[model samples]
Target: MIDINFGSLFTVELLHSYYKDQLCPDFNILPSNQTVKTLGGHQIIARQYSNQLITGVNCNGKINPPKPFTAIETGAQFTFFMQLNNPLFFNYTNLSSATPGKIYYFTNRNNNVSNGKTFLSSKIAVYNAANTYAPGDLVSNGTGITYRAIGSSKPGNTFNLTNANHWMVVDKNQYLTEADALKWMPSISAYQFASPQASVNISVLGYDNIATTYTQSVFSKTIAFANPASSFPLDLSFLQSGKYSLTVNGIQQWIYINDELSDSKTFAVIDIFNDASPVSCNLIDGSGALINPAPHYSIYFLNRATIWKYILASKQSGNINDTANLYHFANPASVITSLTPIPLSNKALNLKLTLNNHDYSPIACADPQRLVTITKGTDTYPCSEIFLNF
Candidate 1:
């Protein structure tokens, strides 16, 4: 019997061997970096413009400092879940008790830099301290010392000076200084941090353009896309000229394909396979334009143990006018849910139910106690409401 010791193996492999075939991504050909403003890490990261709590996203833990087995550089361009509970940046921030959309302003006190901060009209969207704001009117808060928005054209955006509850007032200690300010912006804001996952000088892929080969880690899975590519719909034969490659970020069974031709044609997702659960899709076009697919499909299992399926025969194209990040893609594959036909109850009630949007519905049974009224455009129909307990 031969005994093999694993401990001696580490002594065998040299440091250079670990990075032998390792390739530092081509910074040039890759897509644009996802420029963003990083807030706090491993610590409570927040911001204030004219003295209010605009947004204070917390860092993993001891953010400003490094910990054991945790590299400070890991928090460099990205935040780590090990330090912060999220470990992932898919954070959903909404208006809550302590948080609300607040105005963030950046003014050149000295006006030294040629291209000083440019002020963008504030909206309901999130704002970091990196933005430019013109103080509106200086009004007194209930505390008597009031803060104001910079622009006079609009009503003065004021904050409570007494309490730090406002979105623009973080404790002097928690606020980010100018040195670490850019991290609080959006990732796509620059070209450095996000360079690794890009293919060419493009940040987001154009229709039919091949995306840079990259890997993304989400939750507990690492998804790799083959030289990420894009597709646009044309005559079906034209699209067939490209080769199809696939990489999956979900379970190994789930798949997404990258079909790219040598020339710059539009890229289209060939298929999404092995998705047995409820899901949604975003249908958009090149230049991040949202294209409404006339025919759309959906399938989902409600939280109450019921399955549903829908097929949209047509859509109102106007709905796709939102921005790139806000665009939605539609389902290309047939939605397969566990929606079995069940017999409707025979019971009849005074207040009958009326359902609409029958265009996306398939032939299925309905609850006898309720009435169904489906409408696709001007056409309308009332399904036979027969009641039989059996």
Candidate 2:
């Protein structure tokens, strides 16, 4: 599907109730090929497709954890949960239009002879033998009739369809719908889309840079494409681009690194920036500050990190210990050309630099704002623009 990429401004404009503009899920546009070309403009990148996975017993019939038969259509950018074995015999509740006793062939969204060939190659394990299936959705040797992903004609999972030993096609994201996609996994990130509903074919290079100190960008959580350090979460929602604050009581205390709430990563743990009792300490900047906690920034009792991310917003009173440690990011733009004398605390952290057009502006130090960018080797990294107070 083609989409317009006016700016984050447009995405913001959409926050209001009702469909002010069409970014994704604007189904009215799916009329024909010409309609696809018209709305699926340059800005509308990627398609959201359904990638299915299964969770049955890994053995001949037992189901397992983390699931099996899991596949990700990187083009759609999500995983699927297709329990590839026979349907389970639900007493009553677990039946649907697409369920047992009803073996139906979902004709290709883009039906064609080649599409026919792809389905033939695909295979689905039927768990519930009691259910009535299609007259001939399956085909097996003399052992028994098995439900085939296809019927007749050119057989096999098409193109890269089902043709695989363990079907997980790398980092593929199908540009599809959220209801279908996020079932792939939430915080995995999902979006509605306009469509040819086909895979997006572009030479995408996902990379990132780690600056000792980073200058801020305007995006509440900027669309930082590069990868980050091992400690940060891969589902970089909080770090993306958005606005959120840390408050104690009602006053503001600190800011987070990115926009959106941070989700749990495999190795992620939240370290407290402030507390009442001082652990071994390192004083930073002019002040070894441990100020009061604003309502928004209070952590009653630091909780252990697991799959869930919970900010310590003080709900009860017992967990109050108002000692905090402060850390400042090194201002990046203030280039110290050749300071024989290091500008210490006597001088505020400041830097002077010449300005030209939009290149040399001070970074907007705001929370959830973007802080990084990725450039190819030939392209210059953007640290030189930071002008700080000396």
Candidate 3:
């Protein structure tokens, strides 16, 4: 056996030649410049603003500097993890300290320039002696005494005081001379540094239009840049066509996915099986507005009893007004105070639930003297009427 080092001078064909005698000879290495962000690699991490006392989050991982990495350039995306001890959460809570399972998402709003600095055009200047500086240098003389040097210059202590053209102050303060007096002094305010936060929070919520309630409650998770990276992808397909809320730490945003056909608003082809008949029909309400099938079906079953009561009152006394106040969407939980079977006669006529703008259910009522009361939670709907035609 012989050892061979490709040493960056490699190709798929070269590797395949050595294994030409094998069954599967196709082999190649992945290129290093792939754009896909992976959990296995290093990523920059930052904090998300919130009202919690998290102190700080520390991840034992490394941050891969932004593409074209330089002292001025920062990465756009952050790759992090969710580990037990690696993230090391420190919440100021009483029970178990921090909320064990929280969710979070990354955002680019906090991607601020270094010290919020702006790179501006520089001017030509000469070297100085009284002051010491470097080329491509930007220095703050004091709180507001800042300068950018087009060329290296040390124009002595009073050069800037005499408005020397060698140095340029970003903003000349009202006390400009006093600030420039201590340009090179070892002042604590001169050194500025900012390290990005270690972790961020994410929240996701889903909703359904027909259900009139959240598809699911808001879920939260926190991510950190820690050792033994514990990263995972999130799925939010359950929201369907309705709007959703996504919060990264404290910043919130609403997202709406347009799944509706642009040409139509009242109809929706919910379950079409390759252009065939007998698929689930378009779900619509009395107003012809499209609605979810599950929620619509639930409303039909819930109001089954109320539909029966209305039919009974109308037929017995030939009084259509007796059932006028009855709503099509009846409450299924409604109680039956009394249900009496009226004798059938030639005057009796069969009425369909669909005629009253209600969905078809298996239940049917032939009697005209049935009294029922539907109790929905704490509310009660009592139907106790003896109809009589005047």
lDDT of each: 0.20, 0.19, 0.26
**lDDT (Cα, tens digit) per residue for candidate 1, span 1-390:** 432211100000001101123111111111101212322221223222221112222212332221212112311221110011221111111101111211112111111111121111111112323344322112222222223322212134433333222222211111111211111111112222222342322211112212212233221323243655342111122222112222222112122112221122211111111111111111122222222321122110000001122222332211111122221222232222111211112221122111232222123322322334333233232222332111
The model with the greater TM-score, 1 or 2, is 2
lDDT of 2 by residue, 1-390 (tens): 432222110000001011122121211101123223422332222222222111111111132111112221111111111122212111110112132212211111111112112121112332233433321122222222222211112323221224321121211111111111111122334332233222221111111112211223322222332443222222423243211222212233222222112332111111111111121111111132211221111001000100101111222111111122111222222222211111111112222223222232222111111122223232211111212322
Q: Which residue ranges in model 3 land beyond 4 Å of their true spot?
A: 1-256, 259-269, 273-303, 307-379, 382-386
Evaluate model 3: give its lDDT: 0.26
Candidate 2 similarity to native, TM-score: 0.14
TM-score of each: 0.14, 0.14, 0.16
User: Against the true structure, whose lDDT is highest?
Assistant: 3
Off by over 4 Å in 1: 1-170, 175-390
lDDT: the better of candidates 1 and 2:
1
Q: If the candidates were sorted by their lDDT against the true structure, best first, what order would they fall in?
A: 3, 1, 2
For residues 1-390, could you state the per-residue lDDT of candidate 3 as single tens digits? 332211110011111101123111111112112212321232211222221101111222133211111111112122222122312111100011122112121111211112222111111122244666532234555444445442334545334523433344434211111111101111111111133435556686764323423355556778675643333334444434323566654765554322232222211011111111111112122332222221110000000111224433333222122133322333321222222212222122333233234433323332324435444333343232332211
Model 3 quality (TM-score): 0.16
lDDT (Cα, 0-100) at 309 in candidate 1? 23
Span of 10 residues, lowest total lDDT, candidate 3: 295-304
Error of 3 at 284 (Å): 28
How badly does each model clash, as a count of residue pairs?
74, 80, 24
